[model samples]
Target: MASIHILLLFLSCTSFVYRCDGACAEPESDTQAVVGRGFKLGCLSCKRRSEVKATATVEWYFKAKGEVDFVQIYTYTEMGPTIENEHFLDRLDWNGSKRSNDIQDASIYILNVTLNDTGTYRCFFNRILNYDNYEYTTVVSKVVYLTVVEKATRGTASIVSEVMMYVTIIGLQVWLLIEMIYCYRKISAAGEEALREAANAEYLAIASESKDNCAGAQVGE
Candidate 1:
C-alpha cells in the first residue's frame, strides 16, 4: 500500500508538470515571493486570441517543490475567484478584472507568502469560442513560475548608484583621452627641438669651411 501511494504521488507530480507545459498555448507569466512578503501573479488576456464562451471558467493550479501533486489553489468565474483551497483560503485576493462576461486580466495577489508557497502555478481558461455558429470549446492557459525564498537580498542598484557608475566611467574615459593627447604633444615637441639643434650644427660647419677656403685663396694670391 505504501508503494502504491508513492507511485500515485509520483504520477500526479509528473502529470502536473506535463499538463502545465502541454496545455498552456498562451503567453506565460512568472513572479517571485520573498518569505513573509507579498507578491503579485500577473496574467494579461488583452485583445484575446479568441472569443470566450458565455459560461467560461478560469482555474489556477499550484505544484510545490518536492511534491508530485498539483493543488487546485483557486478558481474564477463570472462571480469571482473562489477560495476553495485551504492553503490559500485567506491569503488569496482577486486582483483580476471582475468582468465575467468577458474575462481578461486574470491576475492574483498573494499576501504573506511563505516558503511552502513556492512552486509552479498554471492558469487555465476553459471557454467555448464562437466560430460561425459552431461553438468550439478550447482551453487557453498561462504558466507562472513562482519562487519563494527564506532570505532575499535587494540586488537592484539604486538610481543614484546607477547614475554615479555611469558618471565615473565617463570620467575615466575622458581622462584617458586627455593623457593620450598630452603624451603625443610632448613627444612631437621633443622631436622638433632635436631637428632644430641638428640644423644649427650643420650650418655652423658649412660657414667654417667657407672661411677656411677664402683664407687659402688669399694666401695663394
Candidate 2:
C-alpha cells in the first residue's frame, strides 16, 4: 500500500510539472479576425531555465497595410498594460500571464475589432534573467499578419489539426489509465499469492506439532 501511494504521488508530481512547465513553443496565430468581435493575438516566449528568476516587459507594434513603418501601440510590464496609441485606446488588453513577473505568454486581446485593425502585429519580449552572480538579458519577438473579415471562417487545416490534437490527447489518457489498472491488478495478485502461501505454511506447521503431541501422549500412556 505504501509503495502504491508513493507511485501515485510520483505520477501526480510528474504530471503537474509537465502541465505547468511553460516551455517555449512558437505556434502561428490565426490570421483572420472578425470585425466588431474580440480577437486574441497569441504570443509565447518561455524561459529556457524555469528555475532562474526573471522579469519581462512586453511591447506590441503594428503596421497597417499602407503604413510606412511599424508604430508602437501597446506595452506591458510589472506596472501593468499601457496603450500607447490612441487608436487602440480601451480596445487592447493584456491576455497573458498576470500573477508572475516571469511572463511566458504575452498574448493580447483586441475588443470590437475593425477593418482598420487589419495589419501586421509584432510582440516583443525583453527579459532579464537574475542569476546568483549576475543578470542576463534576452530579447525575443513574434510577428502575426492579421486580416479583418466580415465573417469568421475556420480553415480546413486548422480544423484538422484541432481534431487530431484532441484525438491524441484522449488516446494518451486512455492508455495511461489502462496501464495503471494493469499494474494494480498485477500487484494485487502477487500480494494475494503471498498471503496464501503464508497461510498454508502456518497450517502445515500446526498440524505437524499436533501429530508430535499425540505420539508423545501415546508413548507416555
Candidate 3:
C-alpha cells in the first residue's frame, strides 16, 4: 500500500510539471520584418520538425503605429484564402502557392509601400484538436516589427523606437536582477533561522536531562 501511494504521488507530480510546461501548446515561429519600401517579411521555424496537426487556421494582421484598428490582410481557412483588406488585396501575395496546415512557410509581399505601413504585425493560429469525444482550442501569437522608409533617406522614427525599446528591456533586466538578489538574501536568512531553532532545541533537551540527573543525585545522598 505504501509503495502504491508513493507511485501515485510521483505520477501526480509528473503530470503537474508537464502541464506547467505547456503541454499540447502550439509552438510559436520567429518573425522578421525589414525596412525596405518593398520587401518580404519571412517567418522562420525555430525547429525542423513539423509537429502541428493539419486543419489549423492561420491568420495575419497588420496594425499601424498609434492606431487601434487591426486590419486583417490574409486568412487561411478550410474554405480558402480570404482577402478582406482592399489596400493589400493586390500587393500581398503568398511566397509559396502551396499551403499545408502542418508546414508554416507563410510570407507576405508589400509592393509600393509607404511610411504608414510601419508598425507591429503578428501571425497567429487558432488550433482545434479532436480528442476522444471532444475538441480543444489553443491560440499562439508571435509579433514582427515592420518599418517602411523612403528610398533615399533613413527614417529616424524607427531608430528612436528601437533605442527606446532596448532601454525598456534593460530596465526589465535590472529589475529582475534586484528581485533575484532580494530572494537569495531572504532564503539565506530563513535557512539561518531554521539552524538556530534546531540548535536551541538541542541545548534545551540536554539542559533538562542535566537538571534531572542533579535531582536524582541529591535524592540518593
Candidate 4:
C-alpha cells in the first residue's frame, strides 16, 4: 500500500509538470476591451509532435477600424521583441512563451487601450522543426477582431454559467454534509449497543459469583 501511494504521487507530479510545460490548448481571445484598460490578444500555435525540437518567431499585425491594409506592429524573435508601428510604441508587450525559443503561445498585451485601437489583429508564427538529418518549416496565423467600449457588459451566457457554478457548489456541500451526518449516527448507534452488551455481561458475572459464595456458606453450616 505504501509503494502504491508513492507511485501514485509520482504519476500525479509528472502529469502536473507535463501540463505546466504546455497543455497545447487553443482558446479564443476575448474580443471586447474596455477603454483605458489592458487587454491580451491570445494566439497559440502548438506543435503537433512535442518530441521534435523546434524554434519559432512571432509577428503581429494590426488594421485600424477603417484601414485598407494591415500594418506590422510587433515582432518577437530570439533577439527579443521589437515594436514596428509608431501607434503602438511602448504600448504593446510580449505576453507569451519564455525561457525557450520553441514559441507555442504567441499572445500579446496592449496597455491603455483606446477606441482607436479597435480593429482586426493578426498573429503569425514561423516555426522551424529540427530533425536528426533535416529541418522543416511551417507558418501559422490567427486573427482576432476587437471592439472597444466605454463600459464592459456581461453576456447572458456568462451570467448563466456563474449561477450554475454556484448552484453546483451548494448542492455538493449539502450532499457532503448529509453523508457526514449519516456516518456519525451509524457509528454512535454501534458504540451505544456495544456499551449495553458490556454492562449486561458484567452484571451477570457479579450475580453468578454471589450465588456461588452463598452455596459455599450453606455447605459450611
For this target, which candidate reaches the highest lDDT against the unseen true structure? 4
What's the distance in Å from true for residue 92, model 3?
0.8
lDDT ranking, best first? 4, 2, 1, 3
lDDT of 3: 0.67
Clashes of 1: 1
For each candidate, give its TM-score against the true structure. 0.53, 0.64, 0.45, 0.77
Runs of candidate 2 with Cα error greater than 4 angstroms are 1-24, 159-221
**Clashing residue pairs for model 2:** none
lDDT of 2 by residue, 11-80 (tens): 9999999997855776777889999999999998878887899999999999998897999999999999
For every model shown, the clashing-pair count is: 1, 0, 0, 0
Whole-model Cα lDDT of every candidate shown, in order: 0.76, 0.93, 0.67, 0.94
The order of the candidates by TM-score, greatest first, is 4, 2, 1, 3
Q: Candidate 4, overall lDDT?
A: 0.94
Candidate 3 Cα errors over 4 Å, as ranges? 1-37, 44-52, 96-99, 130-134, 152-221
Better of 2 and 3 by TM-score: 2
lDDT (Cα, 0-100) at 136 in candidate 2: 96
Task: Please tell me which model should have the higher TM-score, number 3 or number 4.
Answer: 4
